[model samples]
Target chain A: MRASAESNGGGADDDAAQVMGDGRHARHVTLKDVAELAGVSVSTVSLVMNEKKNARIAVKTQERVNRAIRELHYRPNALAQNLVTGTSKFIGLLTDSIATTPFAGQIIHGAQDRAWKQGYVLLIVNTEGNEDIERQAIRMFLEYKVHGILYSTWYHHEITLPQSLKDMNTVLVNCYSDTENLISVVPDEFNGGRTAAKMLLEQGHRRVAFINTTVESPARTGRLAGYRRALAEQGIAEDPSLIVDAEPTQEGGRAVAEVIRASGATGVCCHNDRVAMGLYDALRNRGIMVPSDISVVGFDDQEVIAAHMLPPLSTVALPHYELGASGVDAVLAPPVHLDDHRVLIACPAVHRESISALD
Target chain B: MRASAESNGGGADDDAAQVMGDGRHARHVTLKDVAELAGVSVSTVSLVMNEKKNARIAVKTQERVNRAIRELHYRPNALAQNLVTGTSKFIGLLTDSIATTPFAGQIIHGAQDRAWKQGYVLLIVNTEGNEDIERQAIRMFLEYKVHGILYSTWYHHEITLPQSLKDMNTVLVNCYSDTENLISVVPDEFNGGRTAAKMLLEQGHRRVAFINTTVESPARTGRLAGYRRALAEQGIAEDPSLIVDAEPTQEGGRAVAEVIRASGATGVCCHNDRVAMGLYDALRNRGIMVPSDISVVGFDDQEVIAAHMLPPLSTVALPHYELGASGVDAVLAPPVHLDDHRVLIACPAVHRESISALD
Candidate 1:
């Protein structure tokens, strides 16, 4: 397709085995073979394969070419076509430990599905936070002439944009950049936290406890604000005593159970499912049953933990798939400034049996 | 490098930006530019870059070329090098659903690490079990002239070889072919099962119950045999009544807990960590404690479930990482016949708090 006339020197219908650059012997069915079989020129076959509307070819000749192609099973060379078309149909996805994280699978899945639908393929590189590997991977992406790149992370966080990626069409997924040079798709943490709080409030629990994670993150601040807002909407004053900070783990949940019990709260919102699980264990140890004694809700509906809990935990989904799909859309879409240079995907509330209506 | 004389038509020392096929404008410093800066021929620069032994260039000239390379930040174009060298330093990895599976991360990580160590980059395609995508991906791989392919599955199982892969150099990872046409690296299920049984046996538990999954698989059959073998080695007759079969999940663990308890077994080995977790819950419900009442062992040391259990699960590792690394080795190795056309990686035993020595 890229003026490869020199490649047609091999006699038509030679049926010769081609030795690939990789030293693999492959019986390549070249355009010359099909053209010779159809009694047409190589350009005619290429035009037919590319379906060029501008090229005027006789219907009978086109039919002959099609039949030859079917018989020989000629697959047009994508690399050669790419050279002429000036598009590789490739999108590079660079992730910081997405493959190793169980919940992050949906991101790749969503990105792959959207890329496939758009007639592109994703070339993924999991950097595992190794800066050297990230830089080398970027060089490889440049060599491949990838159409665009989707820089993603396993969790929502801010990252310093790699200087090398500045010249490329890059979009961040489940992560953002401090410099707003590139667009990004991240979860709406504030609303996700609000939804977790509302789940308990709608069950008629007036006194709700927000067990925030001690680690400083957008989730820590956003969810706390959302929880307070939800209480205020219900004519309940924000009580600072109801907010407790602990590690965002099962152990953290167990450690905070005594404090929660002493506060006289009817419902509690955990930072994540792991914390809720720890709370469940501690409550059982103290002979305090969930829902009946203290209705609980969690964030991050991690399927394994949340779904398999004694009573499946009600939580908020992280919108990983949506973030991935949106990142691809942003990278492929026409270059335009987005509001705030970011797209906030909603974290949906998942209702489970962890919460019960108050009498 | 292959004869790329045609590419040398451009004038040297021209700082012109090259428009890539993907329409990305990149300031690519060419070999000619480096040669011009070093006051040497382009061929000499290439010889220095490739470190050709036969080409005796002056040490002073080599230093000059190296200095120019460092100053200009010139990177050899991998695509051009691939075209001339007849070898693209790219290994294609095609997986059925590794991206979505929780435990399959190690496979990609291992393969990526090994490939990088060998100066090769991996181009992965997660087909998600889609035949059309798989076929298309293979065609793309062929067009790019990949050096080799590693066809992997998320789990250790048997699969039909894709017809198109017959001519290509492919090695199966965590999966095998019934036809035995291609070499494969799979986990030693028999040894993995044996390890699980031995963990309880070593704790002086003679009457050990094996809670196997009802689903017929290599794991079920292999583990059962291994369990019986361990008992036989201990001079204990196999007790058929002690073997219970249920689903492979947590629910499956709960369903068979009663049978395990009724058998008067002091120790039990479960199909997986999920089952072990479920058994823990069911045992607590029945006022039976783990290790104190009935020592437990699980398979598949799934960190999240196994480590987070009230008492950490003692189980066997699946060797996912080893299987993946072995697959890469097999593909890159010289074409030679392998023993039985397969490489079985060992599954190591993981000791945790779930088991206790008898007093």
Candidate 2:
């Protein structure tokens, strides 16, 4: 417990009156006053307010106390009570762009749904990737005595943990730390990659080409790895010529159509839905038809893109909802390994209209 | 000043000590303890903490008290201090989907930026569009003594304002009331329509067509109104045959391509970018070149579609950022008229490669 020695100079217990003199807030109903009005002790008032039945106070006395409370309209200050109990029914969510990124809102939505079910209220602070503001927000959360904190980022990336977050109970969402000293809940991008490849392979395409994003992204590494693992499981040799590189946009996909066509691959797997859509456009412009001339698969089942694509893109989902809800669960449960706890949720394949079996 | 009379049974202000007896939380530092450590009075400690140099305490004595505060870590309880000042450096943001809608996060971001700059903290509650939850959330905000409230919706719609919100300082964002009782910040969709049509007309387009959403949506009414006004200004007789209806989606745009072509309007305006993209898709399938054989325009410059379109859609932007930022400004300012304060922000034109000038 973070506490200190109790030392005080004797004086008339006039703190409430002094605060009332300041006249900035509505006059609060203190326990001391409730006890006097009910002709009971301060402990009796506290017990009644907390709804402790063990005190065995008379029904009549309880009714009188309840009437006094109603008349005074004394609402308990959870913050003040948290000082004595050291338990706060509050969770603080720290995010970089969950508030600004439309897709990322699901993270907060999933977390809030779980937190509310557990009788905890969620307070979110969007730090907007500003380290100074992050530190300031953390201090504010500490002052509020939050039970735990969920630190999240907009995308899958590695982050330097804020030094101020060292001692607090926290869970990382959609990002990780090298130290492995904090509980991390991130998307299984590698699995998603495999899933995309599997979706294509299951459709009976051996010469499925992989259109990759920029080489530097961790997503690229993980997803490519998954794609290879899936191909290997089907007793297929890694085709060095089949793996192609493109920017992670529709134009990038379109620009690489020559490689896609020259490979004579019956199908293709794009880094994301955007790239897949771009490939679709490129093929259409080249007088090629999807699922008739070739099949295509994508990752990140972004609704606006994947669901609206002409053929309705067959893709791998990011598991955003699960990642968020799992982070909240992991923080509340606080696994036995504590700092070393890591949870990886699966990214399932969403089959729409883009993929077709070649056999 | 929503306050009540003080009523209670008081002994020696044993509230703090009794709460400590609950054996849960860390013992918090109090003003009495600070006064004793500083060898001054409790009032003096309060004044120093409140930074009231006018309390007449000697500078030397004040420094001593400050040192004592640092040593004791006597951070004031903002919740308690707020009682006297009536000003809480806190803002409450209530929404149906700020955390869930990607675009709506910008509203919070804009509001939080303003609030943080003004030394206020924002606590957000996502009510999930439930009336009971909305009411429950409002009660919680009231209990926290928030300085102001911002109620927002996911999309623009007329809302039955919650009865519980009448007394609190609140401003509606991206929505409106039938009664005009609350300050509302809504998108100027009508002007956006005018801008879209005007952009094409300015480029020497005489036969301009308007594709609209269902006539029920305020967005449709507003945008179409603007389109008609722009045509009327140019003395171009409104072509009733040029007006068409479609769902607000790509498919809807694709389905109406023949009508767009048959209307023989060199320049066409669809309800939104998605519909424009659909039209682009439909036209592409027919080998109709955008801005070559025909010119195209759209609204709600959704980044996913607009920025990435083959021709990069030329469309009208929804003023989401300004609408959110303005709501924060309005709530904090509490307009002189209080009720009936309406702010209409413009939706500007984002010109990309889609719209072409005629010979």
Candidate 3:
């Protein structure tokens, strides 16, 4: 491995030598040198190298700058620039699981997509849901002097701040901290719940049931609040018996569905997509037809459930990509002037064929 | 930000003030000082500080060393150590999508789990499915002087690497490169296929169809190879008509089912869980019973699809978590003799109720 390493590095130097136009050795080529070689302004060379030369310089001039950069083997000194500017151009994304769940991955994509457009690199760390590991990861980020921290959680829960991170600019995604200063961005669960209820109610369904996991779960609570809000907006009285709490699994959905049938509810709103999935099986086993015997709606618009349900599930969609993008925005935003901190992103409703109009 | 910056360096000194136990102005409290204070070796202090001292020293001695290190507040100079040793404790994980898929998340979790256990930190970057971006990210990894690289692709495809990465020790996860010398740990696609076929054959199914997206996809090719091998072992002649290519989506599964029914196939295997979802819709629409009229199997065992399918889907599971963990292992493994390269991991099969006996 070491033998090949020396040869490859030597080969790179040789390749550069072949591309050199003159024997003039300046040690490291700068933007000014590239500009001089290309016969363009230094800023013009910078713009061209940064891929922002469009509309600022003629296409031919841009081409010349690029050619000069390639000929000189010019590489930007990102680390030195970061040291001088005190901004690393690196955003530290602390995710509990960046690669485990589709939600976190989508969020990272949205955040990175925006960050890259703005010429920033993401220093992502997957903590794997361990608090001690997370604390150590954050300490490393601080040592690296990252510009901001985007703390993304796998589930909705209270987050504890690392001592080293107490002073840093941070934005929490899908989680909240008791600390007063940290900003948080989460999906609009209340709106999602309200939308699910409105969709089923609009289909002329009365006596709708809300099947959820635990009231302790913030997402469940927010969705339940939205359901109540929507019912009140429609001048319908909220019934406590219609709301059943169960686990957020297939078994949970199945168990709750049985209760829904016994309660004589013709429409059901699930806390999230997974619950909706279980309802499908329970309904099927009981010879209940979705959108025929009863209408069903879910939240989160999880791709597998929404698309694959016997009747494609009508559900409220969490703007996960938007949540991540906006979380980055929150972290990068100027420090909050006041103590009150909250950033709620809108969760839009997605309509499919799961709900049928009651005759 | 500037105000905080000026005060930041001073706070450490002030924090160090509390450690002046000897009355000799604390002597700057370096690692050497900690070694002297604890009356133990410097390497022992390092192992203790980094939490690797558990196995190396007696428990009482370890506690004494830890207490001394904490009292001194001697933070290990990570950057200085990296520069001196030429080994950054950071591992670079390069992925095509940062936050879009659940598979990537599981892989990351596994990698992070292993990395944490070893006291190595992962520095992750998302490539956004663009070759140019991937090249830039890898270059950044090189510039950062990461000890190793873990390159994960969103889909199974051959990747052309940057020249700078030619000498770098890298482990390809969920993807492979044509380069002969690179070590890669990819999911065992052939085994996955064979497992799927064996499961169906064991259930007394004489004839089964393989529904895939494309003939050229590596995952499909491996699976097909496994399918044929299983059939051959069972003394069944391979049927060309049994292999059907369809889109790996819900609509695609539905379309393939239409073709499968016309061909009189009694059992079907899908390229992925998503396609299996489409099969569910098609089967339900035609009023065909699952595992009754036809038994169906899927791959990738995506949670949403497996749980919600009218009858939960039986799928050949991709060891996503193991893939990540194994990639880290390959990265951290002592360099295999300068010549040997390539590591392949096996994917385990998971059975649900999606398939049934033809008897």
Fnat per candidate, as a fraction, reads 0.29, 0.25, 0.29
Supply DockQ values for each candidate: 0.23, 0.21, 0.17
Query: Model 3 Cα displacement at A260 (Å)?
Result: 3.4
Per-prediction TM-score, please?
Answer: 0.82, 0.84, 0.75
Stretches off by above 4 angstroms in model 1 are: A1-75, A85-87, A334-337, B1-76, B85-87, B334-337
Best by TM-score: 2
Measured by lDDT, the strongest candidate is: 1
Query: Quality of candidate 1's docking, in CAPRI categories?
Result: incorrect
**Count of residue pairs whose backbone atoms collide, per candidate:** 2, 22, 9
What are the chain A TM-scores of the candidates, in order? 0.84, 0.83, 0.79
Question: Model 3's DockQ?
Answer: 0.17
Q: What does candidate 3's lDDT look like per residue over B1-359, in tens digits? A: 22222333333344223222223222234455566668898667767766653456778878788777687664455543443333456778888762467655777778777886777777677766677877777767655556678888766657776565665666777777776457667777788889888888999887889897764767878888999999899999988888899887777888877788877777888898888878876776677878788888888878555755667888888787787888888776633543335455676767778787876
Write model 1 residue lDDT over B1-359, tens digit each, in one string: 11122343353212121222223434345666678779999779888998877899999999999998897666656654554333467788899988667778678878887887787877778898999999988987877667778999987778988998877778888888878567788888888888888998888999999888887767888888888888888999988999989888877888888998999999998988888878887888888888899999988787456766777788898877777788888777733556767788898998889898986
What's the chain B TM-score of candidate 1?
0.82
Model 2 chain A, TM-score vs. native: 0.83
Specify the highest-DockQ model's number.
1
Name the candidate, 1 or 3, with the larger DockQ value: 1
Q: Residue-wise lDDT of candidate 3 within A120-200, one digit each (tens)?
A: 677677776777877878777655556678888766667776666665666788888876457778776778788889998
